[model samples]
Target chain A: MNRLLAATLLSLVSSPVLACDAVQLGTIEVEQAWSRASIGTSRPGVVYLTIRNAGTEDDALVSIDTPISGMPMLHETVVTDGIASMPHAMEVPVPADATVALEPGGYHGMLMDLTQVLKEGESFPVTLTFRNAGEVTVPVSVQGVGATDAGCSENNG
Target chain B: MRLTRLQKALWVAAGLAIVAFGVLVTIMNRAPEPAAQASFRPTFSLPDAEGRLRTAAEFEGKHLLVFFGFTNCPDVCPTTLSEVGQVMDDLGDEAEEVQPLFISIDPERDRELGLAEYTNAFHPAILGLAGDQAQTRAAADSFHIYYEREDTADASGEYSMSHSPALYLVGPEGDWLRQFTYGTPASDIVSDLQSRL
Candidate 1:
């Protein structure tokens, strides 16, 4: 009976790792890392997520890396006088104890020269580098092209 | 001097007639003015997602919602197209009369297949279009669209483009109808389109 109970308890403990979409490390909580599925033959794919710094010290997102693309660059879409422009961002700021959303129409990461299409329902690992919090590897869930509201949380459910 | 009964009735009838005429004139003056006619819509024969040459003449009896953007556009294009998709949803059956096309300003990056993938991903009805630089420029000049290509640090000759985000609504007869500014709600677009239809 004790052996059976131990097995059941072990299964319960391992389930959280499979269900959790959030990765909390040190003072940073990264949630909802997601990307839209690439359209036919589109080489570049975009990724978005929310980074929250729960600690008092501010952090800067130094860089990002993923196996799906050799060069993942930070970019933001700027609109002036009804003109839309996407400019390269050298670094992104994560204010202390505040949440910063890297979402559509704002800050985003471009996966340049994707070797393969980012299909829907597929999840890939992306490593994010922070000046203060170090590096954390998060899974980015791929969603449909029209998906803006759907995220890793929904897919986790 | 007191008038006779017949004369009094005749006088009252004349007064009533004059009051009716005054009311009629007031209503005529108060009625709203007619809507101003739109300028001529610029026509183009661009390659669609399938690499097929599609012309403005093909959609002669259907209204078109044309927008200019590129596939690499991560933010505004998707947002606007998604909103346009919502407008299509709100339209229901009337959407059959309305067709949406996404014209690529960056033809170098947005090829026929890529354009097809990007546009139809938002809404099935949204068709993607692309053409060479000269064709794009001519189309832009005709539509009065302003766009600029900014060089990027990447070595692959890949660059970013900046262009207007307005949604152009073209009439069934290939005439310019209206332009919806960016961030306009889907309900407003649907209502405007419904009223026009």
Candidate 2:
């Protein structure tokens, strides 16, 4: 009975880990990384995630690399006077003890010139380089074409 | 000077006619103006994916759902187009009455990048439109859509085109119907279109 119970518990513990969850590195915790399924491979893809800094010192996301795209850069979408413009962001600042969210219509990681099509229900790895925390690779769940959030539960299937 | 019965009856009829006329005028004045009267009716004459020239007049009997964006857009454009695809799906059989047009603000690059393939990835009902610089500017001006190319280019010698993100709805008679702001849910748009249809 003890052996059977252990097996069941092990499966339960491993299940959630398989899903796109959180990854911790040093004082930074990255979670809820996700991207929408790309419509075309020629068009650029985007990644949105949240970074939480627990340390006293501030950190900034210096660079991002993903195998899906050759060129990954930080971009901010700004809307002014009804015109939407996306300017390249050199880095995203993560203040100490604060959470910075890279979401839709705001800050996002632009995956330029995607090497492959991002299909729904698939997850990919993106390595984010932070000035203080170094490099932390997190799995990004691919949601529906129009999904606004990571929705890890829904994408787990 | 009292009038005879026939004269008195005619005077009463005239008085009632004047009151009815006054009420009619008041109702007319209070009625809401047509949407086209309140706003400009946008028009576009551009080339489709097949390089066929298409004009606003061709879709006079159907509702036009227009969005201006470029193929190279990373986030907002794709998200909005996906929502539009969902809206078209939710519309079901009623979808035939609707025509969705994705006008490329960056016509040169969009044409080279295959505008049709990009839009078809979202929904087949969406017709990708592109034109020369002058033609594109004219169409954008008619819709009051502002778009400008950034002066800087990335390492790949590629630049970004900034443009308006609002989705416009035009009636069958080419009247300005409504504008759906960015991030509006597909369900909400479906309900709105159903009511209007």
Candidate that would win on DockQ:
2
Model 1, A1-157: lDDT tens digits are 9999987645533332321367888999887788877764355788888888999999988799988887788998777876778889888999998999888788899888787777777666788999989999887777777777444345542
Give me candidate 1's TM-score against the actual structure: 0.76
Tens-digit lDDT track of model 2 for A1-157 = 9999987646533342433566899989888888888866887899999898999999999999999998889999988877889999999999999999898888999998899988887777789999978998887777777676777665531
Worst 10 residues of 1 chain B by lDDT: B29-38
Model 2: how far residue A68 lies from native, Å: 3.1
Task: Put down candidate 1 lDDT per residue, B31-75, tens digits, no spaces.
Answer: 763332337777887888677888888998888998998877777
Q: Residues B115-165, candidate 2: write the lDDT tens digits.
A: 888888789999999999999999998887789988556456778888889
Per-prediction backbone clash count: 0, 0
DockQ of 1: 0.44
Clashing pairs in 1: none
Q: How far does residue B40 in candidate 2 sit from its true spot (Å)?
A: 1.7
User: What do the candidate models score in CA lDDT, each in turn?
Assistant: 0.80, 0.86
